[model samples]
Target: MDRPTNPTLIILAFFAIYVIWGSTYLLNKIAVTELPAFMLAGLRFVVAGILILIIAKIMRLHILINWRQFFNTIIAGFLFLSFGNGVVVWALKFVDSGFAALEISAQPLLILLLMRVLQGKKIQLMSVVGVVLGFIGIYLLVSQKEIIRQEGSVLGMFLIFLAMLSWGYGSLFVSKADLPKNYLVNTGYQMLTGGGLMLLFSPIIGEKWTSPVSWSTEVQLSMLLLILFGSIVAFTAFNYLLQVVSPEKVATSTYVNPIIALILGWYFLDEQITLQSIIAAIVLLTGVYFINTRKKLVLFSRFSGKLSENK
Candidate 1:
């Protein structure tokens, strides 16, 4: 099927990514409440992975996967999904949901920093500014009186940063890695590797699969929503944008997701949204603009020369 090439589709795709991905934190909170965190996420990926594979089959998508691709995807999956994402579920066991959300929001800063350090990429000027603003925003947002009292959450906040650092670095690897060009195939492999690892870890961590194996309808429904929206729809939208938009533009969704997360946190969990969080929101978006659009901030980026050679 020929994909639609319109401003509308592009805009919708961006929005879907922005809002849907952002709300995933709250979903994790709810799902974790009734279900084991790692196990729940594991089941989610397993279900979503199968569903995506099924859909890919129906669409007859071409998958030119090699053994090396599977291994690469598995490694990428283990790093990005299991460690990057799975850490959130693990940390949430001991932290406030909102605080966890905020910490994860700091990913772009970590990504930019890591890229410069690990990949020898030059830092974009605007992204540098964005990181500054993002930190300021975090400070402001964290001013809620009760949250201020939780020192351990500060530690947990740092842990989530580590999670996102892994996520951001993994994203770079995703861009550079040789794998199936088909998005579904890449995602399927990632889901399997990461999901499988989490399940494996669950047993080691003493994740008892719980007595009365039959799950409640609520758990079943949550699983369905995660598979359909979080896994299938959000990932498809993400991959589609990779083809249609500049990565910088698609990355703006990083900023957009936090707002969605904040709002969803407010709506579903009735979590208090403080005035400081609003101030922080502005700072965060500014940082996001800098982070994703740093190329524009760099005069040298337009030179089209080797950024490394200059450095």
Candidate 2:
């Protein structure tokens, strides 16, 4: 029989995913300004992965999986973290944190279209409307002359678009992929493999590595917050919520994350949130809401939920 869940824990879990995950954008923005993007992301995930495994070990949770599960975790890790997240971190060099978050808010729409193309799943009428609005919102957001004219801004936006594709495909893959039974172990493996890959690629792409001891106090604190709260605590809470609450309720992070990110970015980073951007955010998020209106479309898989968090 299933044990009863505490309401307080549920609320706390929701807070972690909602607030902590949203704030990761600002954290990454701060760190990337001073550190090499891949290096920063790689170190963050590798350290977070180690800590998660340690915690799991202390709890005596199963930490070993078959070779197949290990291999699949690597693939999922590459798609979701190495490309989906690492590339986005690189893009942050040119784009505002809030802008990136707003653009990424269209992830559900991408998943819907990917389902049509890859899986031959029919898009429902409401979802079709969502796809249209999502595109319009994207166009509005990207068409701003001042934003696009910035050096490397177009490239950043393009890379972010590619990251969305990777994340969308990763979501579909994880939904059907063979993974470890324990959610914590599954996440640790993905982070470990993904972060390892980034560390390997960082030097090859000519990104300089620096010791963390030399980082500015702000960057150091950002990395610590990212590893501890953004990756581990928020993700654990996400998995906990998945078990206790309805997936749709858990998926509400889709609507809240970008808003939180926008507000935090504006306040802390002094990133501009223009009126046009606001309109675009509304249109884009409304589309996400429609696409997710069907319970069947909710990204209920623990991995996909993590993807939705945009961490």
Q: Top model by lDDT, which number?
A: 2
Instruction: Give residue 94's lDDT in candidate 1 (0 to 100).
Output: 60
Off by over 4 Å in 2: 295-311
Give Cα distance to truth, residue 298, candidate 2, Å.
20
Q: For each candidate in the order shown, give its overall lDDT on alpha carbons.
A: 0.76, 0.93
Q: Model 1: per-residue lDDT, tens digit, 1-311?
A: 65567888777788779877776777787777777877888777876777777788888987557898888888888778788878787776666566576666777777788888888998766777888988887777665666767656665666677788888878888788888788787788789778988888888988868532477776676677777888888888888898887787777776677777778877888877777777777777778677767346345565646766688
**lDDT, residue 22, model 2:** 94
Q: What lDDT, from 0 to 1, does candidate 1 have?
A: 0.76
- Report model 1's TM-score to 2 decimal places: 0.84
User: 163, model 1: CA deviation in Å?
Assistant: 0.7
TM-score of each: 0.84, 0.93
The deviation in Å at residue 117 for candidate 2 is: 0.4
